[model samples]
Target chain A: MSNRYEARFSAVGGQGVLLAGDILGLAAQKFEGRYSLQSPTYTAQVRGGPTKIDVIIDDEPVMYPKTTAINFFLSLAQGSYDAFLYDLRDDAIVVIDPVLVTKWDEKYKTYQVPVIEITKTKVGKMIMSSVLSLGIMIELTQVVSKEAIEKALLQKAPKGTEELNLKALRTGYEEAQKLLAQET
Target chain B: MSSASSEKSDIVFWQGNEVVARAAIAAGCRFYGGYPITPSSEIAAVMAELLPEVGGTFIQMEDEIAAMGTVIGASLVGKKSLTATSGPGFSLKLEHLGYACIAEVPCVIVNVMRGGPSTGLPTAPAQADVMQAKWGTHGDHPTIALAPAFHREIYLDTIKAFNISEKYRVPVIILIDEVLGHMSEGMIIPDPSEYEIIDRVKPSVPPEEYNPYDTQYGDVPPMANYFEGYRFHVTGLNHGANGFPTTVPDICHNDEVRMIQKVMKDVDTLTEYDEYMLEDAEVAVFAFGSTARGAKMAVEKARQEGLKVGLFRAITLWPFPEKVIHELGQRVKAFVVPEMNLGQMILEVERSVHKEMPIVGVNKVGGVPVPPYEILEKIKEVLQHA
Candidate 1:
C-alpha cells in the first residue's frame, strides 16, 4: 500500500547490471535526488555469475536500501527469478520475457513482455532487453516523465546505440501495454 | 609560509574509500601498501591510481603483514605511508602493527571493517572491530584510532589519523566499515592549504650527534631521512637512544612504558564521539560505523513514534571511549550494543558500564548487518523492561 517502491533487478554479471545500477542512479540524480539507492551485490565469480542490483527510490531520505520485500522484481533470466522470487512482495508485479523466462505463472500479475522479442525486432540484438525493460519500468513507475527519463538516458548512455535503445524502450512499452490488456 | 605545490577545491561528492586515499595523499603519504579485500579494495584501487599520478607509489602486497611491513619501512624514509583493509586483513596486520608500535614507526592504517572472525561477510559493514583495533596487538602499547561515521569525515578524520601518527611516531588506525567505505555522498573537500599536514621532526643536528631512540628531548628524537645522508638502525627489540638491542628489564620496561604514555597522555584530545537523546532517555543504544548509521535511523524513527531513545557512537575506538560510556551508563537505565559480530564491543561496554544495569547486545553474524528494525526492537525491549 506504500507509494514508496523499489526495483530489484537480477541477472548474471555479463548482463550489464552494474551499468544498469549506474544508469538508474543517474536517472534519480537527474530527477532531483529522489532518495534513491543503487546497491549491487557481485559475487566472486568474475563473469557469467549471479548479479543482483537493489534500486530503492523512496519519497524520503533512505537510510539503508535492503528489505525482505521488493515491490518490483525483474528476472532477465529464469534462474534469476527462481533465486529471488521467494522474497517478492505477494502483490508485487513481475515482468519477464517469455523467451528469457521459460516458465512463469500467467495467472498472476506476471506479464510476459516478450522483452527479447521486442529487442530483436527493434534493435536486432537481444542485448537491448535491458533497454526495453527500462521502457516498461518507466511506463509503470510514473514517478518521472518518460520523456525526462529518455533525456536522462541520452545524456548518460555512451556514444552510439542511444537512439536505438530509445526505440527499443518504446517497443517494450507498447508490448507491455498489450500484454497487460490481455491479462485484464 | 608555504612549500611549492597547492590545489583548491571547496567541496565535492566523494566515496569514503576515495576520501581515505585522498586524505593519505594530502597527508604527504607517497606510499600506499595494502592487499585487496571487500569494501576496502576501493581504497587500494584508488591509491593505485592516485599515488603514481603524484610521483608516489602503490603496491598490492601479498598479504596484510607485508603491507604493514612495507608501510613502516617507507615511513622511515621520511615518506608518509598508509594501508587499508578489513577484519581478516586487519587481523593479519596486527603482528606487524605491533612491530610498528614497538619500533615507533608513524604510519596510518585504514580498517574498513566487515563482519568477522573469519571471512564473515565481505559486503556488510560491522563495528565489532572496535576492541580488536585497540587490543589486536599482543602487548600494552598506545594506539591512536579514529572512527568516522560519514563520507566527509572519512576524509577529514583521515587527516586526523595521519596527524596523530606523525606527531606520536606510532601507527594510527582509521576505523570505518564496509558501509562507509562504499557509500558515496556529497562532501566538502578542503583546499590543501586549509589543513596543516604534520611531518615527523627530522634531526637538524649532524648524523654523528643523532640518537634514534632518545627519550630525553620530549620523548621523540629527530629522525633524519635516508636521502639526507643520516642513517640509523630501527629495531623491534628495546633499544637505547642509540638504537641498539637492550634486554635490561629496567631499560625495556621504561622504553615500552614511555611509548604507551606518549599517546595515552593525550587520549583526551583523541577520543571523539557523538551522543544524542541520552540526557533524558532511560535507554541508550551504543553502536559505531555502519551499525551507528542504522542506530541513527532507528532512533529517529522511534522518536517520531514517541519513544525516548538515545544513541552513542564511538568515533575513537582505541584507548576506548570509556568517558562517554561511563557517563551514559549511569544516566541510562539500559545500554544496547548493536553490531555485526557476536558481542565484540558489547564486552567492552559491559566492562566500562555498571554491570548492575541491563546491558543487552544486538548481534548478527554470517556477513549481514544488524538491521535497524532489530535495533529498534531492542530499544523497545529495554524500555519495557526499564
Candidate 2:
C-alpha cells in the first residue's frame, strides 16, 4: 500500500455518493487506524446536478484536503465522468457504472460494473447503488478492509434496511472479486 | 453524563461544522441563537438538537439581527451564548456586533464564510470576510477574530474563542470558510477535564457600589448579571465608568481609549500562529484560514525541490501579529501571501514589514481556494526577482 491514496466519487445529486464518501472516511479513520480527509462539492440544486467527493487516505496527516491527482476514479454517470476526466492521473484506475456511463476512453485501464442494476435487484432501492459501488471499490483497490467498511455501513445505513444493504454490498464485492480473478 | 465522558474517547471522524457545535457544548455554552444560512446552517441544526438534550437553550430567530441580539441578551444574564451564520447573515448581524462591543458583552459569533458581496456563491468558499470581521461593526472598538485551517483546529479554536471572550469581555469571532466548514477529517475529542475552560469574572463589590465600566483596577471590568440585584445600564452610547450614557469630553475619550488599550496592550497573549519550516528559510508564505492548508503543502513540496520555503499561518486574525512579521521580515528574503480572497490579508503583511522585503500575493476571488501549485509558482517568481 502506498503512503497516500486519493479517490474521487462522482455521481449526480441524491445518489448517496456523498454518504458513501463519509462512510469510507469513517472506516479508514475509526476502524483502520489511518488518517482520512473527505471534501464534497455540489451545486445549490438539491438533485439532478453533478456532485463529487474527494477522499484522501494516508498514514500521515492530510495537509491538503482537496485531491490533487486522482488515484481511483468512480463515475456513476456519463456527465460526471466527462466532467472529472481531466483530474485523473496518467495511470489511474477508472471504474464506471455500465448502465449510466456509456462513453469511455480506450487508453486508460477501465472496469465496468452494473452497480445500479445490482442494487435495484438485490437491495430493492436505487439509492443503495452508492453502497454497492463502494463495495466494488474496496474489493478492487483494497484501500480499506471489508470488516471496517461493514462496521461503518451498519453505523451509517438507514434504519430497518440493514440486511438488504448488507446483501447488496456482499454481492457487489463477490462479483468484483470474480472479475479480477478472471482477468488475472 | 456528558458526551465527552460517555462516548468513546479515541479518535473520531467529524465534519468541521459539527465539531464547532460540539466544542461549544463542551466549553459550557448554554444558549445558542441563530438563523439558518447556507454552509453554516449545519452548525445551527446540530446545536438545535444537542442543546436541549444537554439542558441548554436553542432558539431560531426570525432574522440574523434578532439572532445576534438574542445571544447578546443571554450573555448579559451570565450565560455563554453563541450564534452561527454565513456571509449575508453576518452582514445583518454587524449592528448588534457593535452593540456587543460597546456594551462589553462576552459571546461568540461564528461565520462560516461563503462567497459574498451579496450571496455570490452560497455553496462555495471565500476569505473575503477578513476585513469585514474587523471593521464590519463600524466602530473603533477592539475585535479578536480567529481562523482555523482544518477540522481538528476548528474544535480547539472554538473553545479558545469562548475562553477569550469570557476573559476579556469581548465578542470573539471564529471566521471559517466554506471548504473547512463542509470537510470531514479525523479528530480526537479530548476528555472534558483535559482542557482549560474559563468563565466570566463576576463583580466582587456590593450591588450599590458596583460600576459596570469601572477601569480602576485594569482595562477589563468585572461583569454583573442582569437580575442579580446589580441595576446597571447597557447601551451602545459613549458611556463613562458608571455604564450610563455620557457626553463629557474626558469621560467619552477615556472610555474609547480604554476599549482599544484592553486588547491592544495584550497583543502577545492574544495572538496565536503556526510557523512551519522557518529555520534558516529565505522565502515564507503567509496565509490563513483554509488557504493555509495549501500553503503548508506548497512549502513541503518546495523543500523537496531544494527551496528554502516556509509557512506563516495566522490563527489569530485580528490584532495582527506585527511583531513576529517585523522580526521575520529582517531575515526572510520575500513573503508570498495566498488567500481565497483577492489580496485582503496581504495588505496587513505589507503594512507590518514596512516594505523592507518583496511581498507577493497569489489571490483567488471566484469562490475557489488558491491551489498549492499556484503558491509554489509565486514563491519561485519571488525567489527569482529577489
TM-score of chain B of 1: 0.92
Candidate 2's TM-score = 0.96
* Residue B223, candidate 1: C-alpha displacement in angstroms: 3.5
- For model 2, residues B245-362, the per-residue Cα lDDT tens digits are 9999999888888888899999999999999999888999999989998899899889988999999999999989999998888889999999888788889999998866789899
Cα error, residue A116 of model 2, in Å, equals: 0.9
Model 1 regions more than 4 Å off: A1-5, A58-61, A86-93, A102-111, A124-128, A144-156, A159-184, B1-16, B120-128, B182-196, B216-222
lDDT agreement of model 2 with the native = 0.88
Query: Clashing residue pairs in candidate 2, if any?
Result: none
lDDT of 1 by residue, B33-65 (tens): 999888799899989999998999899988889
The CA lDDT at B33 in model 1 is: 91
